[model samples]
Target chain A: MSAPARSTGVWTAAAGSAAAEPRETASAPPRRRSARRRRRWTGLAFAALPLAVYAVVVLAPLVQSIQYSFFKWDGVSAATWVGFDNYVTFVTDPILRSTFGHVLVLICFFALLPIVLGLFSAALLTRAKQPGMAVYRWIFFLPQVMTTVVIALVFKRIYAPDGPLNQALRAIGLDSLARTWLGDFTWALPALGLIGTWVTFGFCMVLFISGTSAIAPELYEAARMDGAGPFREFFAVTLPGLRGQLAVALTLTMTAALRTFDLVWITTHGGPGTSTLTPAVALYKAAFQNPQVGLAAAIGVVMAVLCLVVALVITRVSERD
Target chain B: MATTVAVVAGLALTMSACAPGGGGGSESSAQPSSISTDIASAGTVTLKMTDFWGSAEGKWIDQAIADFQKKYPNVTIDRTSEDWGQLNSTLNLQLQDDAGPDIASANNGWQSLGTLAKGGLVVNLDSYAKAYGWDSKVPTTIIRQNKFTTDLKTMGSGSWFATPMARTSLIGLYYNADKLKKLGIEPPKTLDELEVDAAKAKTAGEIPFQYGSLDGSTSALLGVQAVLADKNKLNDYVYDVPTVKASDVGMKEAVETVKKWADAGYFPKDFAGIDYQTAVANFVKGQGVFRWEYTGSLGLSTEQQKHFGYVQLPQSGGKTVGVGAAPGAMVISAKSKHPEVAAAFLDYLMSPAAGQTAVDLGLVPALSPDVKVPETSLSLTGESAAAKTLDSDDGYVPYFDWSSPTMLDTLGQNLQLVFAGKMDSGKFTAAVDADRDAFLAGQA
Candidate 1:
């Protein structure tokens, strides 16, 4: 096999040598052809590894999932072709309909809240000369590094009837406010959403901080020169510059919201009359807990399609301006 | 760069060559010579066992595995136990791909085993049971739960799918004995007496009963017991009937009885949201007169066991009944290479001595005659004595959550709705009927 650098050297040298040897054009053509061939083979070898990995890890499972959605299978049994029956069932299932609603609420928690909070924090940090700004950053970023299981468990204890949250409420003489956070149907979903917001805002804040740092100080200075206040300069310069990072953050956080399972499973397991059940949790219950793999696959397929569409829209909109 | 790529490629090839065939292959190949000479000669065997227990419970399993390893020095055990939240999907995914651990701790319910049996994923163990002398020792009812047909088409028809590891009788009603004494109630015997005592307890500013429909198991436990306490209804609904129709008069009566209890505030107001552990905690804290739980819950730590009384749930309308079941079972994987060695391991695990270990860990023994269970483990002391008497009277019935192949989740969820007052009695019954009908029809 030709060494990559050696082949590149041969090609560049041949081109340079051909330019000098104007009289031997016919001989130079054959030598150039061999160099081009070597380069082509080298390029193919480099691309093949990643392509194969992608096919195995991503594309293959995705295709199989789509195919499996059409079958009635309990994962182990003989799969019977049910056409679109599983999908139809998913569309009709009241629980799944409610789950989608929960997923939407989770989007607000995982995406909207984080983005808004991240922006506010970034704006504050960019101007403040606080002594413990670095400490604050570290504290805020702690949740991002903490395992979801630990977070879920800590939250579960806090949400329990006699937990510190309730104790604090009672300590302040707000007796009526001290109720089981995860028990009441009206409160459970919003409570779970609140945890999601808390766990994810750190990630968004970090992303925003990095994105804000990348914005040129010259642009901010120019905005200020144009008589722009901090907010105005932020809108004109900082926000526009961080558009790419925002797109990335929103996509990742939105996906996390849609596919939430650990926190819900650990905390509520879709309890309090299925009030906090998201699509991912419902799919897991259908597949493993209920052994309805066909239904689960159908849910997965639908979720994938929905996520793809939403992500596309979000990406397009984020890129537009 | 070319030299680097070539070196990496060489390393990759070497690694791939040593990658080991799948995962369980090498492990099964390395069984002890006493178990299998070929396995011993092949290399060290390492078997993986998965369970849904963490921390203290996980330590017990690890200790059991270590004990097994001491008896077979050549064989190594790889234990992978996680909490339920993690285990749920991991187990399912592994089992589906035929990449599951050689031994798995599985629930004994039909809903859990039915699909696996149908898929031919679990091994048939009739021959193993006979060779190991397990057939005569394990109770027929307990053994029956693990058996499947030769074709692995249905559970309880072929061979043992899992070995019974634990036994628990759903016999006890946890109550505050001090509170009951204060209310002048001597463990109510009849439904009428129970209601009167409950009212008295409530009047004395105590909760009559504390049960949470949150986890859904409580619904099945209380509902099945209600059906069992009425002999005529049990016969009509469970035995005499050819098919379970929702419109059956006995079922209707049972539903109504439960609803009545709910309406009278016999259960805690937030019962729909409290988990099993919380319900137990509340009972221990003197918040309620009675909380229904399995006999095994009595083995809770001393602090958790304070001042609790165990009594049988009172029979309604002159009949007494309760719910009980053999504990979870272990099944060999059909994909296992050394099925014989796996069978021997299960045999050793179910022996009287090994069975006693489980009993010592607060589970009842499946082999009743040979194993001696401790008095504290067996006794229904304090408030549990009356309940134990009622349970021992041959009126006790097995819980019906395992009655069918796929009704557990449906029943649990629907019951949650019922407890939450989101579904009326008629609607709940209809929903249950529809779910049962659908499941049965699918089986047919």
Candidate 2:
């Protein structure tokens, strides 16, 4: 191939070698230059549309919220300039800080637990390449495919006072342990967190499955010959090989944990005495329900910054490894 | 800063383009101030209306609208519906956008009617009240409950902005008739008797109170407030009179009652986790013997309605005296094209035909003293029970959370802590007092 590519374009055509590389410089210079310039201009024009749309739809709201954070507005009347008063309130307010604490707890359920569960699932599946594996994948992936609203509705019924959960507890002779899961301050937040875990574990599982599949079969075989067990092979081969996938999973799930709204909104609306009071729910209630748009915007800005920083830290750590 | 202004200005321009405003909202529509007492001659105007009426309320309002259209043949009516809790918030946004119904109903509050009035999105009905003699139409006690300042921050003394159609709501004890009869217990007439009844019901393995306080605990709090606070002091707090303090009517007993009820296993094992509808539905399904709910929420079918009996949340070891209530306020959009016609529509809702319709559907309608309401099934059950409280020398008190702008959140989020013994009464009261004081300070 290198010998053929050393020939000029006309000589290559005469040689009739199908593998001969064509030289772009062989084209007429003036026409090619003008056409290339035109293509570049047209490419920019097309890309310009989405970029503009991104700026308007995404960045514009962000900038507007940041601006709103610096004022006192009730979402209707004229905004009063307040400098950093709203942010100061957001950070200092005990209620708001507890909301952040709830978000951190959800991170364990939504990100940490899911990642660990996903790794176990991937390890089991890859070790054996079990029969009907696609079915297993689909079953694992079902939660991710279902809409959050529908999941919330289903879970609401499941967590009802007379729901199957308490009924099951009764059947198992654990009646003393049964209580309203979502309404109890201690249980409500964890119950909400467990739902986050249910929703995200499948997503992590699928990521790890794909990550483990791409591992070299020889690595496993070599590990087996060298006396490495299933768990050992996982750490030495499967886990290390999936660094990129782990980073991706951590980033997606952690960001989801940080900015959770719909689930919390639909489930408890940050209730049972602020036990489930997530920052996202706080922002929404502040803006819409409470009509404190400025404070809501300030909370929103802080949440966005927190998510970005955490995501960056995770990605940086994973890349280092 | 410039960018923010530009975006906001663009948004404002878009809103005004969508909905007509009465000269940027500060003034009412420039249309004729002349109005009529008679609905027949109200002109050939089609009125647009919006409210967060439930299906039952909507059904009766439809009856009212049909009767109205018959009286005013030339007028057409267009209506939009929204969720009860969401309507006011959405209306504020829609009004800001200059795009909503000619007349709207919002629950009276700093969040709802107050926002509308302060935003200059509604008509000041002072002229219409005199023109149509509505001053004589509605009783002052009921009418004053809906009044707000021109600034919309304070209530009790300002020009009236809206007319309340159905204002009489009382938090009453809803007991399962079958369960009570089988258990051979009469509806309790006093607070201690209620606990005795609850204890009996609990022994039958039934949840005594179908109380779920997830959203804000106001439902359960309503029952507790009825148990604790005096009617006059409750009114003073709700009306924002400066002399009253929450500490004066301490909720220590109220908190203890709730905690005791939970510990006694009188409530559902998972009561805190349940939502409003589930609790109500479970009660209706015979899973619970008693429920503490608003007067209007008892929209039981005639057959289903037979299985229930109503009594006020027993207060002060006497005949039930007070229940929480706030009049539902309906206001005309100042930007509406036919302000007179819309105002006339509001007037028609107060007519005999409409009042009868509201009565037939089992709601307490606010109307002239002479309009006779038939003693239907609802009247015998819910309305009669509510009357026992209201007609007692003391009238209904406003909801406890209605005391401040952030009081709902304060009660809603914190009350859960109190019930779960996560926070005691002192901490809960302190948090609530801080919110109320901050709101009052802001008002001043």
Candidate 3:
């Protein structure tokens, strides 16, 4: 087949053809073929170490967990093959089933809230000619750097009935609003979700800020020259430019929300009933606390699949742009 | 791709090999006959032990270890101590490998002790018990608490799997004397009087009980001993007695009493949000009239203990019933290279000297006639509480959580729901019964 006369540099379709030529030319020249073969072997040799480590560390345990998911093992005793019994419990059992709902609510705080706030702040920070922008960026990224346990513990105190949050509310004559934030059944899940929002929104903002800076300045100038206000310019230029960053933010935040354990574990432990119970906490309890290793493995497999699907969906949706 | 597949397959096989194999069941012949109470003959043996007792509460065990080392200078003891949560989470996995501690402090339940015993990771201590005269030194009930069936399915019977390193008495009602005096209330003699006092304290704008439900605090379960009519029934329920339901053991009454307290605003406001530590801290700061606690008292300073008085809650029937549990049972590992030395170490752990150290450090040792308590020791009040329960006709009940692996979670979560008014006492009992039923069904 004849190639196109014009090519789009190294990433063009011609590059694929060029890479394939070395394999396609079987008897073209012995020296060239041997050189090509040597190059291929050297690349493989270089890749072998990391590949082996990944296989042992990641792939091996993943396969073992999947295998363990099908059996009833108490970690100490002999495992009995229970097929999908453990997996079935996740759907059939109300307590386990409710964890999925809790995670969905958390995604609103951990993923959606962060994304919206991140975009708004990124846009504002980028447009403003404010001094100490680096300082502002650092402030926004503080929560991402702080230890999760310290954050959880600090937030636990802040949400206490007589804590500063309640004290401030009471001081403002909102006495009726002051209640056990983490203890109330109706409020515990949301209370934890808000903590998630606080901890994650910073990371999202920093991600979007970098993404916004990377956008071509001429695009924003073109939108502004078209008689567009800041809002219109943002919608026209900034939002479209953030498609890849938004996808990354969504995938990271969504997975983080889904697998939240330490925060809930430290604060409520899915208490005041199983109100704040996340899938990760449930998996942990099953694995270690209850010694239901097989069930925990099943939950692990399910969570991995869910996170993978979410990341793939975000990637596919972003690629459409 | 073929190489990747081969690598993946090879890694998978390696992991499978690392996984602990089946057939952990104990055979009669597997019990080594060379067991001795003396380790001096072992020739400079280093016995490794793991325990959950960190510095604060580890005083007794630390003393015991030091004393043992002095006694058997040839036997150098290596100890790894972590907090309860950290130690328990990793203990079983550690014991599964040969490199695990020669002896580890295992939690006294089917999930921890029973699982370890059943898996044959921990040795049966019946032979050691006989050699060490643990029967005479430790009370029968305390000894039975660590006993388990050969199958390790049932607790409180059959072979001795472990012995108490240190014992925690039935959770006692600890009251602030100054607060009680300020409210013009006398120390309660019965559950009714306790309720009346609590109501009075509430009316006086003081927290009657500084309880927190966060982290699944068992204050309510412990406090329920006041009204618990039959200790053996609750004990049976915890030991996986299939015919007995949680309802039959006055669990509803327990839940209802907690509900009464919650409705009365006796517990700290937003008690569900407050953790056990904060509640105890608040109690120490004079925030509440009473604090139902067990090992928490061990952490109290002398100044705090001056105003604090502990009592085994008395029933209206003139008999006191309470729940008591050991912090953990010290068990020799089946994989230990020096089983006899580990046995001797365990024997030393429950000795009179160790018991004195436990008392001095504000902990209750296992009931021993030989273990004398100093009169000036502030632990006398707590010791008397345990003594009262030990002497009472109803005796002491085991912790309700010990009944099933998930019982603690089920009970703790539902108890919070009951206090939050999201669930009633009936539903609470049913939830626990359901958990028990499920565990029992699985066992069958």
Candidate 4:
């Protein structure tokens, strides 16, 4: 920091000397102020489309959902006033409460493992000069590219009790390990989590890789000159440099974990005694199928809060000096 | 349309403080005034019909549409077919508006009929029932299927709100006769004999029962219902007859008996892993001796139907009690522009031509049996067999899950646990009873 300040003082001195030689410094201040004002206006103009879209699509629905949380409505007939009853249901109902537990379970697969695997891979890639890197990227990113429902369907067949998974287990004489993977009470939720892992890890890896590229080569060389080993270089340079990427990955992946409905719906339907049930699936059924819009809205409000809180924490930590 | 959606959404927001279905700002002005009783209507009206029938089952509907259009060319029929879940959810919300379908086969529960009736989203057909002499024309038992109290809490009691054109579904044991004969086994004569047959068929390397519980274990419920032929208190349990407990001793016995079957390996290996379509396909190819499914739809070629025999899953007392009686019912939306024309078109659905179509397609006629069934192109053996079982001493019991909206989810979740060996019979029945008790408490 002292070296940078000293260099900046020298540069300012050079700039002062240059400015002293017939420069229009008074006009420049006003012109720079006008330019700054123009830039701010341009930024606002660019933000208008997304702002309007967010207002109409996201903001209105979110506000309505929060409002709906206070009612007792079945989507038809009349909605009745039942303050906090829907929220109380989520807190009290065993099934609904357990759905929140499933979200925590999914976080391990969706966010935690993806972050570690992504950081590890990005670190390794930064070490080597490799050819045919795009092929590796495509192979790794294929799961993220495919539709979740289609991926879920393929995995359904693979995890089916009598499917190829069991066949392979039998062929290798590990028959006991090959029960219906998604149907077992103990294994169902984890099996679903692993699919979440497969889907998200690739995306995180790509994100971290791009972030690693933006990291300067000078840092690694400087650490090497200081006699730091490969492992130390990763911790002292790679990790610290990749903080913003880590924050982005964690935020996006945490949202994915919290809002996981489609895969669970397509594959399990929260079956085998609600072992694989998630809040999103429960909220959807409550809203659309049972028409318990009030309860669904309460759940939605909680979900929105979770997303906002995650985003806030991520941005806060990243922005911390 | 967006404006209409926004208006209703706003209305919903403001009316949350009010009592259900009433005394809010807007009245249900779309209610038809004095529906026509005439069997004929020559008005220039297009009636939109909503049902959950696919192409195969929809053939009957298409035939009815073609015939109705020929007879009343001035009336056009626009049809929309949705899957059951989508149809139920959409119609439940949309029925309150004038933009909903003119005619629909309503889901027969508190969700569809109860709310729709209480909210005045459907036309009350009592006056029309009288004018058409439907009281005598349709069977007392069958027509009563549409009866619902004004509050919709009670069923089988109040004004007629809907009418049926055909019986929807019946759960039965459809068996492969050739396979049965090869094993020298008649379709089980009793519940005990059914168990013995299942054991024997399993030993003989044939799947005893074709079953799949993935999409709610409803087929397993059919197996449970087959063992409990005591239909005396079923109505009390299902229709929310007050002071009724769903934990029937006979039902408990049925649950244990099914558990024992699972224990004894009577179910197909990986039966829990498969789905309804795969189970049906396996049965059609003679992979299983008995498949518990709807009696009306064999969906087989004449050659395939010949190899099979349909029976009311071996009665306990020589009295065959089945699940699902009234099938689904067709009702005119209160919001319909031409309620009279829609009502006339509904009458046409029970016509002799439609009845013939029902018979030919091996479908159950919801037309009061006063109308003669037409001879069909396929052999009538399966339909006759189904009809014989249906036309027995005891009446059919409504499905247990159809009592409440969330009952299916409860039954599906807990009962699948029973099949998975995670929960036993007592626990399964208790869980269901608790669910039912909670539902009743909520309603109260």
Candidate 5:
């Protein structure tokens, strides 16, 4: 509160001085701001603690992971430096290579589908001023609040051989089409991805809703007045206004997709023989499950680099006016 | 600004006090000479133990702990459980920081023990074992399973790193007895017979075989076992041979067998993504005639027990060889503060009472001349039957998954690719050969 008061006083004083400067130009005192400079540095140092802690806790370990990538250690033994062997192995290893492909597939479900469906839902919600809009928002966000373990278990049951999905298919006289949804190689990745889409789209929708609410309603009204239809209005007004929120959503969702381990571990443990194996799952198996810590660290570094590059690219694109 | 600095410094100190590693130096010095003795003297020693088994099974462990405390009123046991997924990641961090519980359950495998042993983080139990008579009773086979060479010293050979709480075979076929009866099919005794039974079940409007490969390794293990059985060469393939060659007659035969099974539509198309629990649920719901699962699956609740029958998996060509890793064993960590206490706990668990308790919970006791397990109990009966089969059959072989350190994932995944028709039989054999070669080279 004191800081705000001081800032307002400073602003008022600067304005007054600026107005009076021309009349008494030669008589203006030189502004020796050493004390103010000291204050600013002190304030900055106080502000830097959280960031410093974050860097130490998160960024330091991340950088160490990159360093560890070039070594071979089972976490308990002496580390052996092997140059780019780990990276080479990751790129060339058939299982890891296939796992990377699976991650790409998940990106479609976790990143692309969620954003598209979220935008669509957000658009519809914007036009509908209903009495139970809050309730709908809560319902959509329910999955987000529930633990991934619960979600995976519930979804596993829903996709079971005799579960509702197959039952429904049988009822519709589509017995031939009824197969174990999560168990089939062809359906496993897509089925898991669909769950990812369902769990995440609501978060994206909420982001869009908040972002759209901030945009002036007059712009949408003017677009309609100018003969722009709903679709055109969305593209011209809503989409552009949601660029920042879209960037955030995409970054978060994409990170979630790339780092996906929990739901897969809980539901299928990356099974039916590696059909659902992602980089994170592979990293875990290599590190903790198999004690190939060095290889796991290497995989982790690669993943971090990929995430960083993607994030930077998205941020640059989103920020481009 | 100076006041602000002072305030910040105060906050920093307060936060530092809350940090996890802050108390390490002082706590290390202040800890009691013996954790168990300290508990006894204090009239209540709260020892924390963490495990992967959830609340459902944890309740049994809790009951055991309660019984332990009742016998020794001074010792209070506080038990906590975490999911295996979280535990795997957290264990190393917790161990490194000395924040892990005094006692923890660990899988008696190289992957779990090797790193910790190498790091000199666990307690050595040789002295404790000798003193407690654990050296005599616990079988050499059980001891060998947990042994590891760490820093030129074998940390877990006769020494303990973790206690064997329960034993379960990794490979078995669980069937729905009611469904089998209705379909008028006996449990298959060979690969050909199994195929016929599966076909019959499918024709009778039931899923024949319920196996999930989504984890890739489970599918590969099943496929590998089937192939090994067919060749009547399961043991020779895994341990006796120095190197596995793709062109080797037995190896090629196994790969072909797996491919043939996959092509026959005996396995569900979506079997790859289903988890172990779901696979069991499918068996329970009569969705499948047989489920390839761990022997421990028989221990599932009454609801799960309703439709299932347990049988040893059919061998290739009726050779009747059993294969799987030796059951999980207990080892003592070298760094444990109370190695004697840990050893005592292990000895107690191996006693007739505790062994029976484990058997009652659907775990096989490691010691032979097993205590009389109640036939009515779901946990005891099936495992008892399997144990009886193993005793009678000379062809029982340990699981191939446990043969090589890295083969678990590699073989499992490759087998999946083969089953999915992504890899031909030749390529699948070649891949496994290469993997085995690489693993052997690394071991050397």
Candidate 6:
């Protein structure tokens, strides 16, 4: 920060000194200023379309959603101003409060677990060119490409009591271990979390692998010369090198975790007794099914704030170097 | 960027709250005096109809539309159909617009019907009802289900906002004939007899009930409510009677009975993991002795229908009451171009001919449940018989989900907790009561 500030200060001082030198530049400054003005107009013209589109599609709705959080609306009716009552309800309501805990648990699965496994796999797979590496890459990245709905449906069946998961447990003579994965209250959230891990670990792995490729090979060579094993070598070079990628992956996965709706909706619908409910599912039910559009807007605002905080923290921490 | 967003939001929020359907206020846009019931006055009229019956459930509606079209050649019906949840979720937005449907098939609950009615997006149907003599023709029980107060605070005694289009849903018990016969059990005549038979089935190494609770066990709760709920008492709760509590109408007893059945291992193993469709499919494949479902053998062949017997869960008092409603009820949108033609179409829906068409399509007719039709399948006969009995007795309790906007989610989630032994019936009752009280308080 200090280096950049000092450099900017120097540049400004240089520019000021140049401007102050009035030896021959009476008409020259105006020409340069006009040229700069014309360039600025061109830049504005180029940006006008996207700016308009973004304002209409994103900004207007965002403003409306914030406005909606302050009222009591049944979508079609005259909205009643309730001030911060919806936000208060979101905080005090037990069912709504429980959803935040579910998202936190999901973040462990969707973000942390994936990053660990992703880094592990990237270390192993990207260390050397192995036969069938392309096939492995394809297999790992498969979940990232499939639609969340389809993935959820497939996982729903797989986690069924008689699905292949339980059947496999039974086949291994672990009959007592077999239970309905998605239906059990103790297991439902974790079962959903495992699906999150399955879908995101591959993307994280691909991200880390790409990040590793950008690292200087000399760092690895030096670590090897120092008699460092694979574990030490990874810590010494690969780990530090992938910080930016880790931040990117963390931001994306954490937000995905926070905004999880369709997967939970298609699978459990926050069911077997609200064991798997998330904020997004609650928002949808409030807005669509319960017709509490105001409460839904409040949930949306809170979720957006949470996601923004997570992203900002990750970005700031990653940029600390 | 942040300052700009704050300014925009502050300016908008100060100007107006975002009333989702925009600024008509909560009064009926089309007054009773302005609405004409003269179908002949509107010549070459095209009425856009939006409905939620696009699947096999739509056959009866399609037949009704055809019959109505034949009666009025001058009116052309332009229809759009989608799934039930999809349609209801978007119906408010559609109805608020000028080019929205003339008539829309709406769900019975507060979220769809009550909300739309309160917003004045749909026309008040009292004028049309009197014009078409619906009070005398449509059964009071069915009509009561569609009525909501002009304020939309309570239902069952108010001006009509929607009318059932010949079809309604009924909850009842379905048994496998061969399985019952093999177990040496006659059709259970009472709840005790049913429980005894279930015990026998359990001892005989057969799944007594083909139960799937992934749907929050609401269907099973409906079946339980059929056995347990007192029609009048349940009415007090569902119709927003202020003094009544949820536990007053045997709700806890119903929950206890379901929990007892769960403890007895009467339901299929891992039943919570199975969905309704899969459980129905399993029942058809002879996996369970009995199944609780709505009044249709949807996937059954005629032979299969004959082998399966449909009956209401037997009540101790020899009265039939169940979780049922006019699921395909239609209302005229305030934005409709042809209000009278729409009213006529709705009136035609309550006609005996339309009821006959509903029966022919294996749908339970709401208006005239006793309309005679050739009984090619025994299950249809049983459904009609059950519907007729309920109608005569005024025995239909609105599916309790209509009690509160969030009641569906509350019942669904908490019922699973009760079943899973994570929560008791008392807590479940409290959760439900909280939702109801909150909604009722909002009304006040």
Q: Write the residue-wise lDDT of candidate 6 on A1-321 in tens digits.
A: 011122233334333532546374456666588887798899999999999986776667776788888788888777788888999999899889999999999999999999999999999998888998878888999999999999999998898889999999999999998998887889989999999999999999999999999999999899999999999999989999998889878877888888888888987889888889998899888887887888998988888777667766776788788
lDDT, residue B105, candidate 1: 67
For all candidates, what are the clash counts?
11, 5, 2, 2, 46, 0
**Comparing chain B with the reference, what is the TM-score for each candidate?**
0.72, 0.84, 0.88, 0.84, 0.74, 0.93
Q: Which candidate is the best by DockQ?
A: 6
lDDT tens per residue, model 5, A243-315? 8888878777777787888878776667666778888878877876676666887787777667666666777
* Model 5 per-residue lDDT tens digits across residues B1-444: 999889657744543333222121222112234333233444435566666765335655666776677766876656678886686556655555544566666654445654455555556454455555555655443454455543323322434544444344546667777788999998776566777898898788887877665555354345345435433244434442544354553556666665675677666666655655655666666677876666655356655554466666545444444443334344443335554455555556556666566665656543445567766654346555665455344344545554455667666667767776777767876766666667555545
Tens-place lDDT per residue, model 3, A162-185, is: 899999999999999999898888
Query: On DockQ, who's better, 1 or 6?
Result: 6
lDDT of 1 by residue, B1-444 (tens): 999889656744543343211232222112233333233443567776777766444555666677767776777767777666565445544664555687776665545655555555566665566666777665454465566554433444456667765334565556666777788878755556666887887788888887766556554345335534454343233221326465553445555666677778887876655666777667666788876666656455544444455555555444555554444567777666667656666666666566456545644443433455444522334323433333345454445555454455556666666665777768766775666566555655
Chain A TM-scores for all candidates read 0.85, 0.87, 0.88, 0.86, 0.87, 0.89
Q: Which runs in model 3 stand beyond 4 Å of their true positions? A: A1-37, A224-229, B1-20, B23-29, B32-46, B69-76, B130-140, B296-298, B370-372, B376-379, B388-394
Query: Model 1, stretches more than 4 Å misplaced?
Result: A1-54, A127-129, A221-231, B1-106, B121-166, B178-184, B212-224, B227-242, B246-273, B282-287, B301-307, B314-320, B329-362, B365-396, B403-406
Q: Given the true complex, what DockQ would model 5 score?
A: 0.28
Give the per-residue lDDT of model 4 (tens digit) for A161-193: 778889999999998787867767788889889
Q: Write the per-residue lDDT of candidate 6 for residues B21-129, one digit (tens) a residue.
A: 4464546734657556667657888989998775456777777788788877888888888777888888888887788899999888787888888878888888888
Tens-digit lDDT string for candidate 3 (B44-84): 89888898876546766777788888888998888888878
Error of 6 at A21 (Å): 32
The TM-score between candidate 4 and the true structure equals: 0.88
Candidate 4's residue-wise lDDT over B1-444, tens digit each?
999899768856664645443422233333345656553445577888898887556887888898888887787899888887778777765665567788998877666776677667788777677766777656444565677865666777678888866544667667788888999987776677777888889999988887766555675565566457467576666666646665662566666776677677776777666656767877787788877777555577756656777665546556666665545678878777777788777776756567667766656654434334433322244444444455444355667775666888887788778877788777877777777776666666
Worst 10 residues of 2 chain B by lDDT: B15-24
DockQ of every model listed? 0.18, 0.30, 0.43, 0.29, 0.28, 0.49
Q: Estimate each model's TM-score.
A: 0.73, 0.86, 0.89, 0.88, 0.72, 0.92
- Candidate 6's DockQ: 0.49
